[model samples]
Target: MGPTPSSSNDRSERRKRNAKTTIQSLEPDTLCMIFALLDFFDLVRCSAVCKYWNTIINKSKLLREFYAKQKQNSTEFSNKSTCSETSLKTYLEELAMEHHRVSLQEGLINIDQWKGHSVGFNQCRMKMGLILTGKGDKVMRLWSLESYKCVEEYAVPDTVPLVDFDFDESKIVGLVGTRICIWRRNGKRSIFPSNEGTFVKGLCMRYNDPEAVVGCEDGTARLFDMYSRKCSRIIRMRAGPVTCLCLSDDQLILSGSSLGSITVSGILSDQQVATLRSRITIGGIKTLCYNACSHLVFAGSTSGYTSCWDLRTMRSLWETRVSPNVVYSVQHLRSDKSTLVVGGIDGVLRTLDQNTGQVLASCVMEGNALSSSQNTYGATEKRKGRRLSEGTPIDSIPKSARPPITCLAVGMKKVVTAHNGRHIRLWKFNS
Candidate 1:
């Protein structure tokens, strides 16, 4: 009953021919329609099915259009990717510039050394391309930062050295003995009270336009109106002799006394707002600075400790000893306040983290580069045979004597430090 082999073979061959009716047998148009319905990935997968399907997909007109569109889309995607990459690169570059840590990593480059004043500058302020420095001298000199030369000299009437001085573009104001002296840029000099008083001997002074605040020896801060030339108010600390003071635009006065007490009071208010309390007294505060943007007060003590207190919460933020001796100054740039620059009797310039009180960078005067510069300067002055008789002679100062940092001013990419000696050093940060 079984079928013959030839007959079975013929039946098998017929079945094979019937099975040839597949997707490959579809017309070019139909195949194109089907391929068009598929996404690019599916189309690519279908192309790999067999030779006939692949050839039709590749050669068909409609499918060729799809290929062209896909190519164009790929080109656009590539362009978009490149544009995005370029934009990201530019953004990163700007971010690097904005938060650059050049001073932290590279230390500081001592770019130039010069004499800042006729005497050792105890106070220094820099702004508008000029440096104003005074050592309680009879004259406070204005030195051009670009030229490194004294452009103008402001003289006080009396021979008594100024306690402190401040200047703007219009005029220079200082506390000379018991008198408040002011000199206009136009060569006009004026003294308030026009007389001396025992209670008015200023230890520190700060000037804002139309008003000046002086921390007096009598444990009070005296506010004087520059326009009216009269003492408008006196905020008494009653702690000890006021040694240092800071002024805010809104009439806030923070005065430090010799008895290690700091008081915050407003010129318009009668009572003290708050006293900045410190559990560990590090001698009296030698310098005080206020940052309006942060509502923070910075103080340096005679025993080399520098501290920060937040005025908003009336609490201490941080306190760290920057030197073994007196910390003469504490400052931070307005544009960047994450780091504090502390210079003191140790003759070291230190950059500290504002948040954690960590030492980020430090610079000393005894390096090889500094020694070379000193030697070169001395040799040049000797060759010229013109010794600067003003102040302490820079060439005559011994390299072994590392003078204390008396004052400092911070700028865009540079820091200027004045020592107890007459020399000043300009330190530049790598860009």
Candidate 2:
């Protein structure tokens, strides 16, 4: 009488079957897509859903590719590297605990203690017991880390506000605006460009040759011969301003640009052989570093992403976004342990293990009342126009803590972070 009771029961069974998602029924391509997005925990949950789903995942090439990348990240990059699942998982778990005991190990050349660098709108580097810093007035100061005293000072007559700088034992190279100035024990030399508007954005010293590859705002990279102090060769790319550059072990140059392109080319050759483009456009690549053993390029973008790319296959093995803001610095060491360290405009510092694309350590570069007081008067005043352009709410975060990390240097298990506020902090991690 109730409009057929059997009809209602049959309808209920049909609903039950429709409510369940059976992986076996989905097309192979669809199932693979679902598996691609599932991370470690999600994959474990999927395996428990049913045997058919588990079988599909185990047999798919996607799983194999994932494992291959995991293995590559854990071991030192070698053409002949292999790791078992147990080994990869064990290494990542250990790395995850590497930075748990992190603390403010030492404060070296900080704004609170040493007041030599007047304007503080520069960069800092720590090696051995020496601290290298660039400041206003076109000056570079080398200070003793232990004593926090300036042992040596070098100034380029009138180069105000160094955009970037680097050094080896013999010479210090400073990128002031768009010009490359080399400061050495003997004298200072500035490389003149033929193009009036040619500004050098970044530069990297080559390992095999006595040359420095400089990336310019005009989408050109030039190799400067250190001995002759002249531009040796020119490399042109169809991208935007060359923002960063790095040299691989085999002497290949990997350059990043503001237009979200990464170009690879040989210094001796004339053409850009390969280009890696970011699909999502994370504020364009701002920094580049290399891991020689793995032949992997670590690229940091203004959009807070730090990605690892494979040179041999020309494929991205893994990528990660480390912060909600811009990544200002990226670095990697050529050790068996695959650790990629990054710092950014958000003051977020992270150490990532290449093996699993997981974060090994994360901490913020905190500013003190001194850094706050100093930056309030100097750093902010210089870059007042662009401080609030990144969509970051500065007023809400407190003035003392909002200075973006400008640069970073690593040595002997220690990491040194230089901020826009003339603060330099060092941290130590135990193996």
Candidate 3:
């Protein structure tokens, strides 16, 4: 129908409007600026707007570019600052490195069947291939490397064995009641602290001298002279119930107490150097390992956290949640100490990078029935029961048998882990 001239003019005026913005209307730079300004949620929201925005969002390279620009901006801003944060650069690399080493993907080690679970549970240490163990409280045995057979044994009923002990190439020193005893291949020597009632909690041997330091349950650290068979000196600590001790050469000693305080003191004199605190150590420190090359101190606490400190400044470099259960031991296996071997009450073994405390590899150290015949089929189900493809789990395999790993000993081509009770497992490395 034909409209009146006045109505037609009004309709035509209403139809005439300004041009609206469209997906193709924006420039690349403008679109990137919008994306840069959007948070993750907003970016996702933009993806839902239309097919044009969805294509750009799916590129993913754009988000990476945005991050690069932000990092560049941070660098320029830091250059103008008077002071800088030392740990800021490290924070950028907090994401752990992913290592797809074939050994780890495959099986890392094979159990020596002949030596399988022969020795009962005991406190043990390994040097070279020889395993030094304290059996019960009165006997000690050195196991052979290849055969896992006991080559030498030492015992003294008069010397009561504590739950733990310390050893070296030649001798093993143990805490018996209030007295500390040193046993060798042939004879035995004992040193009695002044207070027989004070329980010995930790022991550290001085390599250069015939002396060792003992930390007592009463918060006192005593130096025992192995040659003189007497107490040398006692260093007092305000932190109660000394728990662990680590010797950094003959001159310097580090002691951990029940309160989560670590004190650095001299072995010869009572001169105290520094104390590194964990703020509140949920479970006093259970174990400590020091890397001389990096000058990094690693302490494992009962609370299942592993913390590393730089020795130069006495500042903690980093802390990481290592396990859900108590961490029993931490040891540096590599010569460069790029990674550490950690054993915990959770029955897990983790290989973590030293610099960032990033876990590079992990596996269960619990019960397994792998034998010489079974290992021929490999560890995982990659070749066993998979349907001609990798990355698939086998429904046939059962769970691992587990108990807490109390100690660990790593070699050039082997790793030995001890149970808290009386089981020891040996693993041989391929390459």
Candidate 4:
């Protein structure tokens, strides 16, 4: 009953041929559907399996279409449910470690210092290797990090305390009072509709679109088209006096209000997507930052609490208490996605691990206490109608109070924080 060796060999070949024929007969759509689940490397290997498979998977149009659908599905699913805090923490930790490794490989250095300044910092921006500081002075100061010197200062007329400023790829744009000013690299300034609103609280530019989102104290968000210099869309926030705004990668606009509430809206469709409420009763929401890569949104409260929300599932992720004093500003570091820098009225600059909501480093300004005591003494003397000895200028407050850290921004290689003292300090982090 034994078969011949030649027959056995031929049977094996026939089986192999039939399997190949079965794979080749699959519709291209079916094949692509299966391929979509695999990662890039796996897809590459699958394309090399046979000519039929290669022809389908390697086609540029097919690959694009497949990935687009996959992305849309992923986004929809992410919005459906929030990931657990435990999972997010672990994921963030891994991301931080990876960032550190990359930083080391590139030989980057992280620097921390108490750059002497009296007033609190309001906002900061970095562009073309230059750091720009915006403060309550209604002036923007430029600093050269390489030279470690204050280079120049641009003054704004009738300054109403610079709230926040953002730099495009080319120029720096600042929101002074209710006006938006564009500053060229050469220090030239141009104001847009100077007499329009009362105050500008937040600004955001769409990642792919040439439009910027501006939030005002009037409780409305306006979309400005950069090319046409026109308002394209206006959105109404439920909680008026929008304190902060952020735009997600998919063009979803998130705005936090003075009422301690967050509202999410779609930019293209102009629809109210979701609303997020905080657990702690605080003064108001002072800041909001979105991490598109992790699908997370962070909202900072005036009471020194920073809360994280899962953007995908519209659920609260976690919350961490920061300074005892009010948190005026919060900036997420891109170099390490897990790191968030919080500036508080307590005059402390604290670095937080976003994953666990843990404080990693705390820098205190040595002169803040002395400055406060001096202010108290001066105030008492003034009440008594007596001229006290000369006290330090309010701008000379030490770096510790971390006051007026109203704005924080990051660049490809550095981080910048601006204070009310008209000072901007630059920091670099190591791998």
Best by TM-score: 1
> Which residue pairs overlap in candidate 1's backbone?
136-161, 136-162
- In candidate 2 the C-alpha lDDT for residue 58 amounts to 64
Clashes of each: 2, 5, 2, 22
TM-score for candidate 4, residues paired by index: 0.61
Off by over 4 Å in 2: 1-116, 159-161, 186-209, 365-402
TM-score of 3: 0.63
Two-way TM-score contest, 2 vs 4, winner: 2
lDDT of 4 at 396: 50
Models 1 onward score TM values of 0.69, 0.62, 0.63, 0.61
At residue 395, candidate 3 shows an lDDT of 28
Tell me the lDDT of model 1 at 367.
Answer: 30
- In model 4, the worst 10-residue window by lDDT is 379-388
The runs of at least 3 residues in candidate 3 whose Cα sits more than 4 Å from the true structure, single-residue gaps closed, are 1-107, 113-122, 135-137, 156-159, 187-209, 279-282, 365-400
Which residue runs of candidate 1 sit more than 4 Å off their true CA positions? 1-101, 104-108, 195-199, 366-401
The candidate scoring highest on lDDT is 1
In order, the Cα lDDT scores of the candidates are 0.70, 0.62, 0.61, 0.61
The residue-level lDDT of candidate 1 at 205 comes to: 84
| Alpha carbon lDDT at 277, candidate 3 | 81
lDDT (Cα, tens digit) per residue for candidate 4, span 316-403: 8678877564676776655356666677666555566666676666543332121211221121110000111233333454544344
Distance from true position, residue 430, model 1, in Å? 1.8
lDDT of 2: 0.62
Q: Estimate, for each residue in 152-219, the C-alpha lDDT of model 3 and write its tens digit.
A: 76664564445456666777776665666667756555445455324455443223347666766777
Model 1: per-residue lDDT, tens digit, 223-334?
A: 8888888888878866578888887656678888766768988789857988997768878888888777667788899988888888888899888877777888887776
